[model samples]
Target: MNLAQRINAFQKLGIFFKQFSTAKIEKHSNSEINTLFFDAFKMQIERAQEFNGWFTKENVLKAFESWSEALSVENLIEWTSKYSFSKNTSPKTIAIIMAGNIPLVGFHDFLSVLITGNKALIKQSSNDKHFLPLIAKFLEHTNPYFKNKITFTDTVLTDFDAVIATGSNNTARYFEHYFGKYPSIIRQNRNSVAILTGKETEEELALLGEDIFQYFGLGCRSVSKLFVPKNYNFDMLFKAIYKFNNIINYKKYENNYDYNKAVYIMSLFNILENGFVMLKEDKSYASPIATVFYEFYDDFDNLLNKLNTEKSDIQCVVSNENVVDFVKFGQTQHPKLWNYADNVDTISFLLKL
Candidate 1:
């Protein structure tokens, strides 16, 4: 199939999933679509487990479910329209450096490249090889022609029309020095933080756990730190999330939990230690293992000044209102077909390219 055909086919798959999710399909007689996805996902998880103990089936299902919901057909179409990639005069190539923090963490990049009728050179994270290949396999089954477009490799970074790299803040310097010659989106280390005005209800606080504990708090979009008004109680938050004690891997997480706790104790740092989580009074934007750094705010002006200085390391501030220009921390790296990393507007950048 041609590039346009591949893009249209992938778009159709996205649309099918959306319709299936909302029970919007007219003939509910066929439930096979849902089962097919589940079976595919199960196979992917089994394959991924061969790589490491971290890629558990339960987590993989959760991640896929979330992506399926977020990338609805209508939303996908809306995002692609904004990019105008389908209407471009010349086709382009996109190189993606995917992150392995969460299952299918690089889905957005895959979706963008496919829907835009461009070839994608994907460098799969060692942590994410199995799941993506499974997705590619399933897509190929859906349409055999896509087999060539979604090429996966560990090392394929050369002569690309554009580049997108996600890594630690320090790695950004390296990516810029290396891939800077081309139009690139280089993301540095940034942590997501939440703001508490001390008025959150029990339900809201529980939902906040979804932002924190989901994916084992591994993604850049995960809340690594938080800002709160002085004297905010932790009881309400902990009590709300205590139900999820089983979700955590006790042995593995405890090792990290103990290591960081010991380091903090030996260094005499002012840290709060809960059985499952740790809270520290630190100025750093990122937190330690199984922990989140928090700072007390006396005034909003002081908070703003502090935020301005650390804006480069901060990804998003989850608040009731839109506190910063960047998307909420949880929303970073979660572009549809149009949104790009580093908060870059994909349409404008691609059009110029």
Candidate 2:
């Protein structure tokens, strides 16, 4: 298919996604494919948590809503316009090793490979093995050209010109050792953090709660750490995020809270807790579930320098302050099509292959 046809198919897919949202499920169109796929998607949303405890129905719907907004015609055109798609270049097979920490987490890479006129060989994480195949069927039905362009594998990934792999630090090493010779983007663990200036309004902080609680804070974009000014009061932050207190009621989260809290007490750590989420003074960027690490910064300039120097370790810096490339509060989860993970342009990388 040509560029317009390709983009139109995804736009239609987005419309299909818009019908499934946490707020409500309503058919906005009479497209027959909706009859085939709508109830299927709803079943996936309902059964997702059974497949992976982290994939709650609410979280799955949120992913659907987010992608619906992201795949609009304007967004697809805007994101793809910057790239040069040479029709003469034969499509390469781009192998993608997906991370399943969040729903449809590997989708961007899958989308990128296909949009750049390449084939995708996907090895999905077992944590999230379900949804994508059905999506592939929907797309194939949307555009027959998509047929034979997508493949999912359970065994070794082979016969690909280049690879895009996302995993933890250890798995990344394995990827480099195996796929090092070929052109590749092998990503390791990276966490998001927020810088607090003590002047944030209650509204902003409450929205920040969304950033923390979404997907049970499993996404790499989830804010796991906080950088606050020295002697900053914690009460305001706690009060602002009280609306998300219900998150603790989830059994998995509550178990984590109890366990982590016990470990903290046994270790004689000075941690602060308000029933659900715990705040511990820690230098680490990656915090465990039910906890957010915090550090005190005496000088703003020094913090900026530290963050800039260690940019590779951070996925995003969320703040109201003007930090270059920083995301706004609560927006970490709502990244646009152009907000490339690890700031690496997947389209550019694919085009080079």
Candidate 3:
């Protein structure tokens, strides 16, 4: 298929995703073969949580909504406008190793490879095995050209020109060792942080609660740490996030809260807690579930320098325009199509291959 055809196919796929993007599924009148796929996909979404505890209906819908909003005609055009696709060039097969941390987490890489006219050989994480394949089926049905272009394997990946892999810091070392000879983009563990200036309105901090509680704070884009000014009041932060206190109603989340709270109490570490979330003074970027690590900064200049120096460990900086290139509060998970992971341009890298 040509570039226009590829874009159209994904645009259709996006439309398919939109049907499931809400608590109540809404079918578009013009959707392709909706009778064949729509109800089936809904069943898959309903059963997703049984397959993986983290894939709650609410979180799955949030992911679908985000992708639906992201895959508009304007977004597809803007995202792909910069690349030149040569019709005469042979398309390569790009292998993708996806992380199952969140629903459809590796889809951008999958979409990038296919949009660039390269075939995709995806090795999906066992924890997140069901949803993407159903979408792939919808794409193939939308356009027959996609049939030969997509493949999913559970075994070791093979016969691909380049690779894109996302995993933890430990798994990254394994990826680098195994895929080192080939051209690759291997992503390591990176966490997002919020920088509080003690000036954010209650509304903004409430929005920040979405960034933290969404997906139960399992996503890399989820803000797991906080960088606050000295003597920042915990009362305000706790009060702003009280709306999400219901998150503790989920058994898995409540278990984590109890466990982490118990560990902290046993260790006699000072922490601030409401019923659902806890904040502890920690320098680490990655925090445990049901907890957000925090550290106080005395000097804004030093904080900026420290964040800059440790950029590799950070995926995004959430702030109120205090830091350069920082993501606004509550906007990290809503990254635009062009917002590449690890700040590595996936499309540019795919174009080179």
Q: Provide C-alpha RMSD values for all models, in order.
A: 4.1, 0.9, 1.3
lDDT of the structure predicted as candidate 2: 0.93
lDDT: which is higher, 1 or 2? 2
Q: Lowest summed lDDT over 10 consecutive residues: which window, candidate 1?
A: 20-29
Ranked candidates, highest TM-score first: 2, 3, 1
For candidate 3, lDDT tens digit of each residue in 246-304?
Answer: 99999999999999999999999999988889999999999999999999999988988
lDDT of 3 at 51: 93
- When summed lDDT is taken over every stretch of 10 residues in candidate 2, the lowest stretch is 83-92
Those runs of model 1 whose alpha carbons end farther than 4 Å from true positions after fitting are 1-8, 15-40, 141-145, 247-249, 322-340
Best by TM-score: 2
Task: Show how many residue pairs clash in every candidate, following the order shown.
Answer: 1, 0, 0
Clashing residue pairs found in predicted model 3: none
- As a whole number from 0 to 100, the lDDT of residue 192 in candidate 3 is 96
For all predicted structures, in order, the TM-scores are 0.84, 0.98, 0.97
Candidate ordering by lDDT (highest first): 2, 3, 1
lDDT of model 1 at position 27: 26
**Candidate 3, residue 75: lDDT:** 93
- Reference-based lDDT, residue 314, model 2: 96
